[model samples]
Target: MPRFAANLSMLYNEHDFLDRFAAAARDGFKAVEYLFPYAWGAADIARRLADHGLQQVLFNAPPGNWDAGERGIACLPGREAEFRAGFSQALEYAQALGCPRIHVMAGLAPAGADRAMLQKTYESNLAWAADLAAKSGRDVLIEPINTRDIPGFFLNRQDDAHGVITRVGSTNLKVQMDLYHCQIVEGDVAMKIRKWLPTGQVGHIQIAGVPMRHEPDLGELNYAYLFDVIDEVSTQSGWTGWIGCEYRPSRAAQPGATSSGLGWLAQRLQ
Candidate 1:
């Protein structure tokens, strides 16, 4: 298997999220992810994992004003204070949860903001967090979420993530090239993965589909062919890591996601 992890946040309406996590482990998921784990104490979640022997793959740091469609806040001007306070909390949450990767979201920037200033702020804060995250042996990564799903959101392209990763200049900081978002923002998903794979700083990977942003196979992207490309990369030296099935389920309890993704992911790992 490719080392799959469940995104607990997306299953909000279906059942108790933590319980769902426990069930995932029982169903044989070795890894998992969460969008926001703030409401649940890390100790409790950690205990649940212990009860099942599951590893948490990654979790998104809290996005400010989530209901307001503010996807993130890392690059905003005059919001450094909020970012500092909020990010501190997020890091603490990650630490307690023993999560290795934190996905930094670049929320919407203020109106009429200076582009140069925003970029500077993004780079500085990322570098600063690199030091802080080092304390926990954790990675701080910026993700390029698609603007189609999150209208007016900042950091909507892989280029933006790539530029910031280059600027931060830290082994602990990198791009979260979401295959789903990349498919929308730009095609050639597997090819880009090959190109960026060498950086070793593309800390994490995620996927859904192109237009619908639903299940991975339900969209135009050919996951079967994509999986083969990834398998090739795995064999090459210096580029291999986890690729999350960060897509929403087409239906409740799709075992194929767990079973099927694992079947293909196992090849990629080899």
Candidate 2:
């Protein structure tokens, strides 16, 4: 079976931060991803995961202004210093936690920025990140956030992600395709998956219900069937990477900070 992972950053509320691992453990998932974990400390999370037999499929270095709608800093100009400092620490954190994947935050576009310049900036940033990852023997993923839900963020499309990585031309760097974002931006999920899977550009995958970004079963993303497709791909090519569940609980809107109910997702994974 293709292993599935939860997005602990959003699921943190559903199980309370402390027990998110246990909730994911119960839900039948052995791996997961999160937006950031600097506040939680590396050792603490690693210990918790060890206790629960869980692994971090991916985790991002702290992105600037997540609350103000900023997702990452990979494309932000004049922020190269920030990206370097932040990612350096993230490498240490990932190494300590034994996480193989780290998502580089490609922050929002600068005010009145030139497209070509922004593209160059992104390419340079990925090269820098890839070098660090290579030395550490870890993989790094760059993500594209959907503009519909996350307005003002740059790097919102799979093509953009692929272009940046291709320019950098490093195996240590690849695209982190968030399905929820793709469904919103491109609308064709499975075909895109196949298109990028062969190039090895699609490094990581995240799933959520459309229209609401909730559980995979809640929206019309067809995750059950999608997983079937993923299974087929895995069989033909032996591609067994993590699929992160990054969604919110609609009814409980309580930030899922303390629900302890997230483990059900693990159980739901086939």
Candidate 3:
């Protein structure tokens, strides 16, 4: 069985942000990840994780003003200085939290902007980020989010992400493969995993049911089979990383309903 990390940003909504660590532990999760941790002090976040004995598997670097619609600043031309500063801040948190990976979100492409310019800035920014992270012995990840969920997101396809990673030519930079987004963007989920896992470019993975982004059991994808495939591939290729449970629970307030729906996850762990 693969180790699963609960995405606190999506799961355990019934609890407050800091309190979600305890909730995840009570619910049988040994690891957790989230969108961002900038709101709280690193010491507080670290204290909560230690209190719950949960590993902080992943968290994104600052995405600029999320409320103002800035998903990330890396790909935004002329924001190189800002992106570097944001990365340094994220690294501080990761080191203090003992977290090993940070997802560097590629900001949205400016409307009618020069495509070539955008890609160049993105590649340069990521290379710089990867170099900085490498010095700290941390890995930088790039996730290809589905455009439907966030229109104009700079990184939206697996191949495109691979191209950027290849161009960056840094071992510290790898793909954060999110199955939910892959299913929506390309649909050959298992094949893609197999293809990428061996390249050693995949640093982390996430899963959610397709079409609804709900519990994996109700999705079009067979997570059970996929998890088995992942184990087999890992054994053969030495790919060891957490498969983040980045899905929203069916009902946050209804304990019975959520627990019943999580049966599929329990079976896999068993």
Kindly indicate the candidate among 1 and 2 with the higher TM-score. Answer: 2
Clashing pairs in 3: none
Candidate 2 per-residue C-alpha lDDT over 1-270 given as tens digits, one digit per residue, 9 for 90 to 100: 657787777775656575888877766678877878888778889888999999877988778777877778777778889889988999999988888998887777767889778778878988988998899898889888887776777778888788877778898897888889998988888888777776767778888889897777777688777777877776776566888878786655555432444443545442
- Per-candidate TM-scores read 0.89, 0.91, 0.97
> What is the lDDT, from 0 to 100, of the residue 76 in candidate 1?
79
Q: Residue 63 deviation, candidate 3, in Å? A: 0.3
Ranking by lDDT: 3, 2, 1
Total clashes in model 2, counting residue pairs 3 or more apart in sequence or in different chains: 21
Error of 1 at 170 (Å): 1.3
The 0-to-1 C-alpha lDDT of every candidate, in the order given, reads 0.73, 0.78, 0.91
Off by over 4 Å in 3: 253-260
**Which candidate gets the maximum lDDT versus the true structure?**
3
